[model samples]
Target: MSVPVLRGMRWWDIAPVLDLEYELFPEDAWSPGMFWSELAHARGPQATRHYVVAQDPAEGRIVGYAGLAAAGGLGDVQTIAVARDQWGTGLGARLLTDLLQHATAFECDEVLLEVRVDNTRAQKLYERFGFEPIGFRRGYYQPGNIDALVMRLHVHDAQGTGNHG
Candidate 1:
């Protein structure tokens, strides 16, 4: 497998990113308006927010993407998605590592995220990065009405290993 290249997401990348967002998150997919809103945040007062796209070197198209918002000691993983075809190809891990690196660069003491209750795969990914379940939000998701698991990761410890949990 070719190594995936990571890059800062540009305005032009939003369309393709939105396509994958819909593909990976059919039921709760964010609309174009929402992605635009997030992009604006990425360029606004929250300029520290990191939004990135991952591409397969061979194809040059976006295969995955991730977002993170860092303010002082707190970080939040806004979202993460991988093309359905690349689900188990480790692209998600690459996107996650990039987010964590960005969080660390921003000097974030901890990173937090909310994962759908049924998304154990994502939970495992977060767990692998030192995130632990801290709480739950009842009826956090709409339509299906699934709950959300709130997870947090502390990145201030001395041992800054790449993989923690």
Candidate 2:
């Protein structure tokens, strides 16, 4: 499959994004209102948040979506999800790479995220990108009270030190 192109989210793209979001996160999917709020953050004055959707160029279908929020030199991975059919096809890695690039663009010192304790696949993915578990959040997830592992990835510049600027 051709690599899906990543681009900014638009008003018309919400339906497909919503579909994928619900498909991947059925129990914990964000509401349309929440997506709208994220869009606001993506376009707000601080303008440090990025919301991107991966799409099929031939048919314009959304295959995945991801976002990151940069605040005071920290980039928090707000979310990332890919259609089940597209999982393990490098789509998730590509989306994550894009989000990390966005973090670098914002010059964040580190990136942070919380993953369900049971999501070993996701944890492995994050680990491959240098994220290390530093703490835990009890009952951080909903519907089933899943615990979360707080992870951090420190970014380094050519100097090999934390990139905080």
In TM-score terms, which candidate is top? 2
Per-residue alpha-carbon lDDT of model 2 for 101-137, expressed as tens digits? Answer: 8888888989999999998988888887878899999
> Cα RMSD to native, each candidate?
2.1, 3.8
Pull out the clashing pairs in model 1.
none
Clashing pairs in 2: none
Candidate models: Cα lDDT each: 0.84, 0.84
lDDT of 1 by residue, 28-141 (tens): 887888777777767755477889999888988798999998887899999998887787887888888888888888889899999998998888887877788999999877
RMSD to native, candidate 2: 3.8
Lowest summed lDDT over 10 consecutive residues: which window, candidate 2? 156-165
Candidate 1, residue 95: Cα displacement in angstroms equals 1.0
